[model samples]
Target: MEPRPLSFYLLAAFFVLFVLFLYGPTLTIGILSFQGPEGGLTFPMRGVSLHWFRDLFQEQAVGDIWGAFRRSLVLGLMVMVTTVVVSVMAGLAFRKRFAGSAVLFYLAITSLVIPSILVSLGVGLIFDQLGLPVHWAGAGFGAQLTWTLPFGLLIMFAVFNRFDKSFEEAARDQGATAWQTIRHVVLPIIAPSLIGVALFGFTLSYDEFARTLLTSGSHNTLPLEIFGMTTNVTTPVIYALGTLTTLFSLLIIGVFLAGVAIMGRMRARAGSDAGKGV
Candidate 1:
């Protein structure tokens, strides 16, 4: 290239600033989390040690951090599984038009327009009126589905929209039943998209705060616990928690990406073998 345009440099600078704006706080927290025992939250690193990290393991005044983490993990998994199943089913169903299909589809996604805090309140009120105890696994789970399911459905819709029906037709031509066609053909082809949906579901549910606020009842999820910590706990331990959770989130994303990569390779390998056989 002879010379790059001035606009290119401007755009590159803008992107760099955007990345800094996005991740700067998290990076700062990660650095501060390594502070020595004497280190305060603000910065000016006193000494480098795993003091705050150790403090997290031997916690006291702050709320139940580990318990909250466990609850968040379990809830994330539950939401991820439900979102994947419901989204896939809804996608398959929507492939064929039925009476009131359009109406039902809009209704399913109506929750996306509603405020999340209101959704949490509504779920809590519903549970109270129904004489059922509001709990994280119950009300929190339902409230979070309202957030995750719509995204999952939207992704599935896009996936199926671009999906070639000839594959299913071919499977049927080979004497496969409807369930067999879905199991052996449709699902395998959509596996990567399902992983994407699961990632959305899990990450959304795990980091959800407003929707889980009123619905989580007595047991706080990790986000709620972290919010609670901001009020009273003035220590680097919070930073340590943040860093660890951030790492865990990244790990989960990496695992899903790795799964997608593995799936793509397997499909490619199978295709090559089939071509050779042909």
Candidate 2:
């Protein structure tokens, strides 16, 4: 290929740096997973082994860790459902301009911008006084809903933003009720976005630590369990878990990307059909 332009070189460099920033820790952990216990902190070729993977399965803490993972998954699914239901309603209500709509919308997005630790502390205190239902593992799901709902709303808003208003108008003009219009016209178009939002919520729910740490009463989620592990005999088993987590994270991202790609192809196909009809 011919010499690239300066802008191309700059963009390429930026891309590389961004990839490094994102994947550096994951790469380090993957490498560590192969490190022998005796070769702690040693770099470059400690003789790769599957000992850590085996140890991870054999660890005494594995049962508790798996329990935490199950709890996290359950919480994440609940959060996803709750977020979708709440966001859909909020999004529909928000479709129209009304007094305080702007205020509500701004506040919904504001939660995401706020630091999680501060919110965690505040929620913890509130739970303390309110005597909320809580255990170490399950204590924080309710608290997490407060954050997840807002995040879901923001995602829903983005999904709804690109909606074709005329479809709703046409449905209404055809004597369709508001509910009918939403059901027939608005919702189908936004289904992909809904899926995207659910995945996003799941990802956030899975990785949530700061808020969970403070709010969790008795149940420890996987992230909390991992944090606890770090304080004690840190092992390559942790690294194995890290690798598995990294794979899971990649899988989630891949699924999301595939969803977006499929949506893009669908949109393209729809556009092509429209052009043909025209």
lDDT of 1 by residue, 114-214 (tens): 88889988888899899998899999999999999999989988999899999999999999999999999999999999999999999999999999999
Q: Give the C-alpha lDDT of model 2.
A: 0.79
Best by TM-score: 1
Clashes of each: 0, 8
lDDT of 1 at 230: 90
Candidate 2: count the clashes.
Answer: 8
Cα lDDT, model 2, residue 220: 85
TM-score of each: 0.95, 0.86
lDDT, each prediction? 0.93, 0.79
| Model 1 residue pairs with clashes | none
